[model samples]
Every structure is written in C-alpha cells, then in structure tokens.
Target: MEDVLELYEQPYDPQQPVVCFDERPCQLIGDVRTPLPIKLGSARRVDYEYERHGMGNVFGYFDGLAQFCGRN
Candidate 1:
C-alpha cells in the first residue's frame, strides 16, 4: 500500500488521474428453525444441515485525488 502511494506522488500531477484497487469478502448466512424451544430444558436445538446461498467478493476502485470517493 505504501509503495502505491509513493509511486503516485513521484510524478505529482494534480490534473492527472490515479486509481486504487481494493476488495472485500462478504458472507451470506441463513437462519434455521430449531426443533426444541429454549424454555423446554431439552439441551438447545440446532439443525445439522444447512444450505449455502453464495459468497460475494466486492471490488472497489477509488480516485486518489477525489476524497477516496469513486466506485466501478
């Protein structure tokens, strides 16, 4: 990250363009119904099976001179 910043500052042109690349991973969760209620005193209940929806990876690009406010 520091290397990227240093490279951008070397040429130093306010009119020129610079962009940063970053990514984030997001997890999807599903709620399952329990067979026993907590008040019944029968050891908590949880489902052994689950369905996987999908995972997401978000890629974001930011304009260095634009207050870090650019997305694609």
Candidate 2:
C-alpha cells in the first residue's frame, strides 16, 4: 500500500480521496432446535445449535483521506 501510494503521489493528491474497494463473504450459524422442557424435579434448559451455511458477499468502499472510515 505504501509503494502504491508513493507512486501515485506524483499524480494523485495526498489530500484527495484514495478509495479502496473490497468484498468478503460472511458466514452465519445457528442451532437446529430448542431443548425440551425438564420435569418439575429435574433441571430444564433451552439450548440452540448452529451450522454454517454459505455466506453472502459484502462490498466495501474506503478512502484514505477519511478520518473515520473503517473500524473493526
């Protein structure tokens, strides 16, 4: 990134917006079913399990000049 920025510095303004474009896929998982109810004397609990499915692709556009752009 520094090399590219240096090369472009001659033509592109440092203060100008130099944006970066990228995309990524995110995955989500969840349990199949909730746990069964327990008897009066026994303990009862509800739990869920999750499995990963194909995630969707996300697109991002970023500029170097922006102060508050990307935050993870």
Which stretches of candidate 2 lie above 4 Å from their native place?
A: 7-16, 35-48, 68-72
TM-scores, one per candidate? 0.49, 0.43
lDDT of 2 by residue, 2-61 (tens): 987674454445466677779988886666677687888888776656677668889998
Residue 16 in model 1: shift from native, Å?
3.0
Q: Give the TM-score (vs. native) of candidate 1.
A: 0.49
lDDT of 2: 0.65
- In terms of TM-score, which candidate is strongest? 1
Best candidate (score: lDDT)? 1
Going through the candidates in order, what is the number of backbone clashes in each? 0, 4
RMSD score of candidate 2 (Å): 6.4
What is candidate 1's CA lDDT for residue 71?
Answer: 28
Q: Write the per-residue lDDT of candidate 1 for residues 1-72, one digit (tens) a residue.
A: 898768666653446657668999987766566466666646777787666678989999866655543322
Error of 2 at 59 (Å): 2.2
